[model samples]
Target: MSHLFWLDLQNLKRIQHLFPKPRGVARSDDRKVLSGISHVIRNGLRWRDAPAEYGPHKTLYNRFVRWSRLGVFARIFRELAQPGPDGKTIMIDSTHLKAHRTAASLSKGGLKPRAIGRTKGGLNSKLNTVCDGRGRPLTFFLSAGQMSDAKGALALLGSLPPAKILLGDKGYDADWFREALAERGIAACIPAHRGRRDPASHDPCMYRKRHRVENLFARLKDWRRIATRYDRCGELFLSAICIAATVIFWL
Candidate 1:
């Protein structure tokens, strides 16, 4: 079995203040429970299957659910992904995650927002992300798998940090998107679609750097929970992504 993941002292100190203050009864050790949460998500194990060294599996499940609902993990991710002075060149892309059958049952009644959607590949969710110059994720957005890349781009437009240029693939080659980038004073380096009569020009050298975002996706998907979607609730699933990103890149 793979060893459990533990937060290093330095990283724990950085995010320690973000955890909510305990009231009434003191909760379990923050470090142990968080490590248990990471181990469960990283290994794609059922909560009940979490190793005992971290604590009771119930504590891990409860803490993950409550904190995900509270957006604590999201806040931690955002705090760590803040751009530095040199974060000028950024890239955007989307990847699909296959959703397990367990996630589909929660979509019944149509009450909860399920990011899962049916495509030629069956049930899946799309993860859209914008990363900084060095391929550190800056923001993330989740949508149904069948949603167009442009729609994902639109959802992430306002969340984009200040940058001099944005690099993307042909999927993002839209007039309105380029115009939107122009409005923000950020130049777009997206290649034109194959069918476009008047193909737009882009810098080959700058566009080459677009692979960094692809690398980011590859690294994020290394975590089993992110590579395959098991959570039915979009919020909970996104929180999983945030936590994974925090540990893999930010921490």
Candidate 2:
């Protein structure tokens, strides 16, 4: 068997309560199934390529897809990412994920939001995130790759945690966004846009800390599944991201 990653007992215990209880006939072992799922996602391998020790590849794939559709992974991530009492400083930013060609097809009728778009760099999706003072992810939003950073910020605005200050790059430097933050009693440490007639003043010292969110993105992209989009469904892709964040940063 190839080298594989498994959730140790401690980490498994952290999320044990989040797994749904089995009904009727008992299902396969949760640990083995989850480990197989993680292995496939971490290595960006196809379901059929999973090693045997994790159980039949079909079991791993079914468990992941079923749980993702049920929002089990999202709930786990949310529970794990709850803001601490001292989470006063927060950061926001976005990163793009390149979509594989196989990800182009959507289900018939297309009611679901694909979140994939064609940019000069081909098909892509954008992940916008907010992280606490220590760079732990708090919440995130997904959008088409062509969406503007300011727009992405707006989408995540309501979900921003309670914080005294927010750190962001100039991409978030809009009058409305600053006004919104002001209304929420949060200070913005964002630099002014190049074309602004009245440049906004920001503390360069505080702005330096904005790299924490970038660092968070760097760590998240280390998961190959997250670095490249393969799921045709946007929710499933976001679930993959949430699972990775939970295991890597929260667990």
Residue 51 miss distance in model 2 (angstroms):
0.8
Show the lowest summed lDDT stretch of 10 residues, model 2: 103-112
RMSD of each candidate relative to the true structure: 1.4, 1.4
lDDT of each prediction vs. the true structure? 0.92, 0.91
**Candidate 1, pairs of clashing residues:** none
TM-scores for every predicted model: 0.97, 0.96
lDDT of 1: 0.92
Q: Which stretches of model 2 miss by more than 4 angstroms?
A: 105-108
Question: Which residue pairs in model 2 clash with each other?
Answer: none
TM-score of 1: 0.97
RMSD of 1: 1.4
Candidate 2 backbone clash number: 0
